[model samples]
Target chain A: MPVETIDRSATDMKAEAAQVSADIDAFFDGLLTPVQDGRERLFAAMRHAALGGGKRLRPLLTVAASRLFAIDRDRALRVGGAIEAIHVYSLIHDDLPCMDDAELRRGKPTVHTVFGEADAVLAGDSLHALAFEILADPATHEDPWVRSDLVLELARAAGTSGMAGGQMMDLAAEGQALDLPAITRLQQLKTGALIEYAVEAACIMAKLPADARTPYRGYARNVGLAFQIADDLIDHNGDTAAAGKPTGRDAEAGKATFVSLLGEDRARQQAQMLIEQAIEHLADHGDEADLLRGIAQYAVARNH
Target chain B: MPVETIDRSATDMKAEAAQVSADIDAFFDGLLTPVQDGRERLFAAMRHAALGGGKRLRPLLTVAASRLFAIDRDRALRVGGAIEAIHVYSLIHDDLPCMDDAELRRGKPTVHTVFGEADAVLAGDSLHALAFEILADPATHEDPWVRSDLVLELARAAGTSGMAGGQMMDLAAEGQALDLPAITRLQQLKTGALIEYAVEAACIMAKLPADARTPYRGYARNVGLAFQIADDLIDHNGDTAAAGKPTGRDAEAGKATFVSLLGEDRARQQAQMLIEQAIEHLADHGDEADLLRGIAQYAVARNH
Candidate 1:
């Protein structure tokens, strides 16, 4: 039987987002259950980082996209959980003393601050491994080919040529005069790659042909860039609590970002244009893709 | 046709080790080739950490074990390369200022020391992702099940239940006395887990039945323990240059280890017995198992 499709209305978008958030929470709770006679502290740190707080946007994107193909919601949730693990691990490491040097995240103490730098590092590392482990398990998909595809795409999205590489560029960009293209490229890798993978994951799960996935890929690309631009706007606006991190750090570090390069008005306009383009890509699909369209709008509108 | 079996002579062990080392070097060279107009620094850091240096013992173990089932040498080499990537990434993170805080590794500056700590962290992160990516590729194995199996096992071995857990235990062991069993369990998870996975990967590649893999698993468990004991002994003896990193740190940290829990005499005796037991596990096999047996002996005998 085909999975139930969600409508594209604002109410459905809110409901879908909440549903994925709860599913992710439950999944992580079960996954991170205490290992008796094991490294309890490590598990604790992992729980703190992974389950502490987040909007679960990547997971929502995965489920929403999967809905278009009538893919199993449970499988989509698992893949989303894996992607979220990678995202949380990245944040944990990024908050380390030697990295972002931030003391707070999601309105809570950073992993390193709460668990010590060493434990935090190990926690992030373990989470990274856990993500791949989750995807490789047969439970993720009956077909080994799909499981391998998920792992392969995730690794590409998260590895040196992707998110990690983007981070390297971000670090290198510090105090350097970067043009719009350089900054665009940096965001594409640092944050965009994983976002793209989340959408692509659904295509893989649905076994959609390459041609069939192009629109979703395009949608993801636009959403990813717009998300980053909105993030820059948020930082420039200095709404610290809403951002869940210190605002104005980008400007403080003399780092060039969308808001800094183009005036705030232009940057905001660019983000809106990207979001329109993002929604346009999903026009071929009916109301089954409504949630995905809703999510693209949410990505730009979200304050935190 | 069955793959050629390696002989058990001392000369053959040396030759096999060198051959695997060369194969891994070539594989990583091709994998880490420069990306044009991309994050060159991150790639450089990855190359420095991965191709910098090591005994390639894990890869050799992978190759030797694969030989038992007459698996393809090139396929075995690719699997070995993936394992080596995991090993190198672990070492890179282990040497971080917040972890081991070591300046030198493999007779050269550690990743964190050469590249800034942030870059080093990202480099390690990227390498870890690259390992899974390599295993998930179709080129690694024609069977998707085999690829997923490799990914799953490696993740389990490297994640919180294994290496990361052990590292956490090690950190927690500081300034606290641990019993022999506790220390043994720690090493088992940390180093032993990956070594065991290296052997198990061959079983997966060969599509051997579970029962057929028992002896190899036993062999791996014993060899893994012996390898750790030897490392403890080397550290106890203050052989810094041979170890390629500072030795005697365990003693300085007041940490319990195989050598500390059991005096040097008993520790050496234990390692020797373990190696013998390891080799004995392969008694049911013919000359096809020679290299694995040789490796067990080398694990205890190697200075580094």
Candidate 2:
């Protein structure tokens, strides 16, 4: 498809999705307002970390999935924002001096560079706790089991076996050569877990049909893989302006990556295949899955 | 009180609180069992940090407060374990190279020293999330609003304005000449917030009457301050063997502390006063507050 056509398609999807996006933003901005006590500064840091920049894709997925079950927008917004909070916290901690040591993220200075490493670490920790708190809020659940399960799901995702475990794997794998399966496993756990959580959480919160959950899991798995592959491509081939980060740094760091192992063309093909698989998995859901399908396509198609 | 009498009282309280301690160990042992997926290691780290430890005071506090309003023993155990998880996480993170840089905690190599800083940091983050997850579990909550509110309170305490903020102050105030109020405020937030959460969470879970809540809060606030002061005193007067870790390190580091500011005798007086206040605040709750009062007394009396 032509670049213009794809851009227009994305715009239309986002345009129709305005209510969900707006609610996500509002929920984030509202919950993050500083209290009168010294606690305000923490919320200020949270708002600073969460409110602006980045794609907000995870939250969007949440809102979209929640809407499919005819759940109210407000409730979805809280869940969506909660996911973003986890994502943002991971990014902040990942950027710290002891971790990725990135100076910038999403075209802005990383949290540590601005707040100092200690504050950044604590801020990330606080955000992680806040996400669970948001998900477990009485307002977010009509049923105690639903609330409890959501909290547990998110905890598992963000905890060691999910995001943190994946991160630990990345730390071990960095600057080391790895075979295809190993690399795939690492990326699947690292980047794929949270993305999968976003989709799974929405389905669970909306209590979607039992049959739909398995296929949606498959759809999410593909989207998650495609998302990481695209990231690999962007790291290799995209410009700083487009990618909003320094490209080619991954190669400089001697990190084993999809493109490095598979070659650019094959990597691109595999990503597209994953996107196709994701769309096919969603075929039974029809119009309710349209935006998700479009997003899957965009995940692989975008240069950034 | 005589040292012999203090030891006898400590022995009595520990015996009375033995079930809470055993229950805490059991819950953790069950929670940390390896799952089919590879998430076992993370919980392993959590179990390592949480299962074997000092007094298990935080969990005991939760149990005592829960008993105030007749929350079932099983529910109290879960909530108590949750509080211990949060406490353990804070301790693990605080011992990291970037934070307190301690080589020992709870008579073992600190989490960062043992697990590596990356895993240590992630473990702390995971435990924070898990704490909320466990508390928010429907199995632990007979009251949905109480559960949600407990999650919110713990989040605030552990997050930026409470524990994190107090930690930031500690990091900034290391060598500074802080006054009594400044020190008190810092300790209240840093050490007191979570203890306050433990008390309030138990009471909330128990569905205590509104009037009953205030005393618990008061009780927690006083004991919280007393704990910090006692900690400072331990660092001042106790030996490594007696204390289970290095002592006098605080003064050597020139860290602003209650003992440094007020002298040993005055600091002891302050701790005693706080403990008395903590006990007095339990007046309305009758014998249900016995364990709590004993725990408060132990706070001031324990060498380690």
Candidate 3:
């Protein structure tokens, strides 16, 4: 990889990170209002699952990428918020007792642990619907074409061949030996699809045509791989306190991951290489790509 | 109510319903092909859950209503297919052990029973995503506005205050005492919302203005109510075999339903009255609405 890294101080990164949580948190807080009717519990569970906690990594990536096109601030937050909603809903479902059966998330009780299985399921489902709702609404983008593409792309990303399909693959792979290619395909479907959506959303919002999107697509592809490797590394050897739930879930489940296949040193090097290449994909852009470049670094650094 | 019934022979209703099942079944068959990969289980589960059975009432209603405007047959089937997908996915979730805890649907084993809980849940999520994907595809409609509207309305109808929200209410209402008004509200959200969407999709495709939709809206509202009453009546006195799944679940769960609150005689009367009124809303239309009229009667008469 070429040495094309852009230098930014820690303060710059910190400032860029500040509003993502606040903005997305506020977006969900407003969207999921409380009710006095029988459905109040559902909304409350949705609020609890969607509003608080987590790194907000997917939305943050979207927001950082949006700066590349100088997209409208409100539109950026809404797009980013919808992406975050999809990510959070996936987490809630993945943590169900019938699924991962975990009790902790973001260092706190999982939605199923706190709200019970029925509410957890409904809450995840409600968030799933709401993500498309936000994207389809005219407020997300004045152009219905953009809104339609966002809905189509997000649905594709999260559907059978996308994140949801990847989840099915992950479950079926339990207690089985998966080679590197199979593991890569699984991770690409599960986590990588949504992450790629986060970056591609900016390109769509920017009105870039299909042919013009190769560079951004390449950028998103690299970022997704790097981000997945970082996650495997975190689950491999990171501190429980920093990692939230636990370390070594992949090993505990006997599931093969990038770290399990490649080892930690190689995984770290692979993630770095992907990040540099991801940054290189944006070589034509000027400093508008700073936050995006910074994000490629942060996705690996925070987890590596 | 003034008599406005369209006298369609039983053979006509049967023939219309025949193609609907075949069409939508083929749609899912094509959408969810078998896979040799790890994700095969997930797609198989989704296929099991989505294809092969049920009343196909929602999709049938969309088809019957589409006749009112002579909507492009292919467009109507796709829209109807998407709505059916949403309905089936909802049923899969509702039948989970944590929710309704049923063992049979369309006289076949539930998805969870056959595929395990994780696969079942993921299948439901995949179908839910597929519904939006189908709607957002340009092939669904040449106009992005039409596609966007369909996506928006479907998402709204399925989201927090739509069909999913109603599911939450139904779960919360178990063993509780709900009055007539409260029960009506619950039924409206739980089942009525999607039924309305099934009818409204036609008007949307026709590009009817908001004010011009009053009659159609009135027709859908009545049909939705009549449909819920019929469902309650089925659960109240329906034979197990004809109903596919066992009947009397509401009574067994001690859930308040229209039949429980209104008595079978009154509930039956109310459904007939609503169906008649629903038919009356179509008085201005010619023979084009005959199939829709038949559906209104079928929704109420099937159980009553």
Q: Of the candidates shown, which would achieve the greatest DockQ relative to the real structure?
A: 3
Off by over 4 Å in 1: A1-8, A36-38, B1-8, B36-38
lDDT of 2 by residue, A105-180 (tens): 8887777777666667777887887787787777887766567667777877876667887777777666678878
Pairs with steric clashes in candidate 3: none
Residues A190-297, model 3: lDDT tens digits? 988998899899889999898888888888888898888988888887877788787878898998989889988999999999998998998898877878788888
TM-score (chain B) of candidate 3:
0.96
**Between candidates 1 and 3, which one is better according to DockQ?**
3
- Clashing residue pairs in candidate 2, if any? none
Tens-place lDDT per residue, model 3, B94-117, is 999999999989888999999999
All candidates: CA RMSD in angstroms? 3.4, 3.5, 1.9
Q: Measured with DockQ on alpha carbons, how good is candidate 2?
A: 0.46
TM-score for every candidate vs. truth? 0.96, 0.89, 0.97
Alpha-carbon DockQ of candidate 3: 0.89
Order of the predicted models by lDDT, top scorer first: 1, 3, 2
lDDT tens digits by residue: candidate 1, A179-233: 9999899998999999999999999999888898999999999999999998898
Candidate with more favorable, higher lDDT: 1 or 3 = 1
